[model samples]
Target: MDPSTLFAVAPTFPMDDVRIRDRSRETMLRSPLTWLPLLGAGAMGFALDAGVAGFVLLLGATVALVSRYWKKRRPAVDAASLRELIGESNAAQDQELKRIIGSLESKGLPQYSLCLGRFLFLKQKIEKDVHRGQHFAVFAQEVEKGVDGICAEVCREITGIRAREERLGEILTSRQPTQLERLESARRESHAAILHAYTSLYQVHAEILGLGSDPTERETVEDPGELPGQRLQEILGGLRDEADMIARTHARIRRTIEECPPAVEAPRPEVVC
Candidate 1:
């Protein structure tokens, strides 16, 4: 919102490093027209040492001063080019974030809510920093942190969820028990795994946002019940596949075990007969 901030040129980070606001120094440097008049004035002042020489030198100085101020106050051609580059970069980042959200939706990932929230937060932070005309190093660091945080959080969620799903699947397959027992155990383990995944995700989310919170603590976001049915479906659909696969694999293993014949001790059994 500060106009001064918008117009101020940052020096710590070069314009090339800035996706926006970088005036091409090379182009500015290459403009020979800038020094041409001064050079001509100097030559004329030397050729004619009359009082006109002093007037010529003074006129040249005035021209130089005005040119400098004009360049500083208005956007130069090179500066406009740099601004375009910055606009492109910002647009690209925005599109990337949108793609991430869309992919999560289509994949029906269980942690969609958490993922979407992180993306939104990051997008907001990036836009704010850019608008505020913040220093380049500070802006870049914040953006980099957000990216790293997103990656870490997503990786943890995925790996943890997969591991828990596998363990539950193993339990169902290897252990022979009543249907009621199996169902109850499966439900309990699934719930634990789901809750654990959410907890871990929440912790990572908070850390990325530079907030502090216990991983075991519940989130303040709206309850699952309050979310739209379709949204919940997208979140839980992938989880359902995992549960189904585990159950099916367990059932197959159980059937194979039941059908296998046990080894017999022939001679020892004959004495009993």
Candidate 2:
């Protein structure tokens, strides 16, 4: 059996002092080896005076059991507190994304491009933080939730950009009669490319939601075959490649939008007819 398959749930996050203490307390409770020395000492006490020693052993055992139960409760409380903190952090991150995206949208083209570049930088930072935190099983769900929310918001924004571009195209079709004839052909190709990009973004969002490992679409084999060595390398390199590819694509689309000229807002015609 695979080592990973053996564990029901993977671990998550950096273990803190509180977690260390709680783990140590639980270790003592679960292992009978912990009481071997105690039992041996109690036996020695018994040899000295059977009745008095028996009573002492009984008292000690009872104390140990009671102490174990008390220590157990504190760990539970610690776990609950950590979960609440994770929940709060996730909420804060959602608000942060909203603020950043809104500010970017409010800016002029050059400024918006710079802001988007910064957003991508910050987004990469958050993703790394979440991955590091994922090593501790206690916080994995929270990390996943935060990451998914970020990805979904990005996809929604991409869809919005596509819709905006379509509206701009329609206005151009009606207003710039002469220019439209020349540009309309090129516009169709550009629209198709943008739609394809939007589709990819939507798929990435779905994969994240499903907790699926990210995979890149490698070059299709002409003969419908893959070299064994290449296949192995792909399996090994998939996760990092998928993440990098996704980030690059998103960054490119953002930069394109930033560089695009603002649509010429057509003046409303006066009632002449």
Candidate 3:
């Protein structure tokens, strides 16, 4: 399977951190504006009491000192503080998050990405109660790397699903074909359901990455031709029992479904075949 088709969800470039406030360059532009106000106060001070001029001068000096100090000081941060800020989460899952973080830190990753300016963004997602029970590992890395890693894993699983589904369809066609009409109907239905489920997940994953609504055309989606009823479970069970393919697929699908918002309807086609 082409990895490109698999994660049409991810961005083409590494997503730089989201900027909640203006950049230093923007702040520099405001320097003239700041001076205008200072000049107004200076003029007003001259027109009024000399005391007012002294007060304005003092205020301007204080502002300059504070701004300089703020720009020069490095924000305090460390792994322990991060853990404390993340505070707590589901015991098992939280431990997993922390473990992953520890591993990344050992590999020389930062506890925060203030330079990128999304440290607060990531921190809120981790520390807030609203995001509890949801996966946060993606935020730990840059958007491109995180999504690419996830897509790679899911692409492998999808390759297996497509392979197994095709194999199952071929077996049914070579043997049963359409002789047992009732059985054939059932096989087609089951296979269709599987395809439908996969399609919804495919679209959902893409939607999460802010790709405009899933552009998957209904006619283009893979159809399962036919799959035996009793044998359907056998195929799924075999793919599952023989290895970790189905389990991984299930996990990936569940993760996407869980992350998507409620109003985002699953994109299932209404084909009877």
Candidate 2 residue lDDT tens string, 57-153 = 6658766765666566766646655655544544554454455445545543344335334444444444444334233243344434433433444
Task: State the lDDT of candidate 3 residue by residue for 7-34, as single tens digits.
Answer: 2333223322222123333444456644
Each candidate: what lDDT?
A: 0.44, 0.45, 0.37
Better of 1 and 3 by lDDT: 1
Could you give the candidate ranking by lDDT, starting with the highest?
2, 1, 3
TM-score of each: 0.32, 0.31, 0.25
Return the top candidate by lDDT: 2
Model 2 clash number: 8
The model with the greatest TM-score is: 1
The parts of candidate 1 lying over 4 Å away from their true place are 1-90, 133-140, 143-171, 175-273
**Which residue pairs in candidate 2 collide?**
11-135, 11-136, 11-137, 12-135, 12-136, 12-137, 13-135, 13-136
Model 3 residue runs over 4 Å out of place are 1-5, 8-63, 72-152, 174-273
* Clash totals for all candidate models: 1, 8, 0
lDDT of 1 by residue, 1-273 (tens): 212111122221233544333445444444566566666666666767637759666666857774786478446655556655545655654554455555545556536536545645654554444333323323343333333343333333333334334444544554344533544554455445445434433433333332222323424543545432233234233433443343454444445434534323234344664
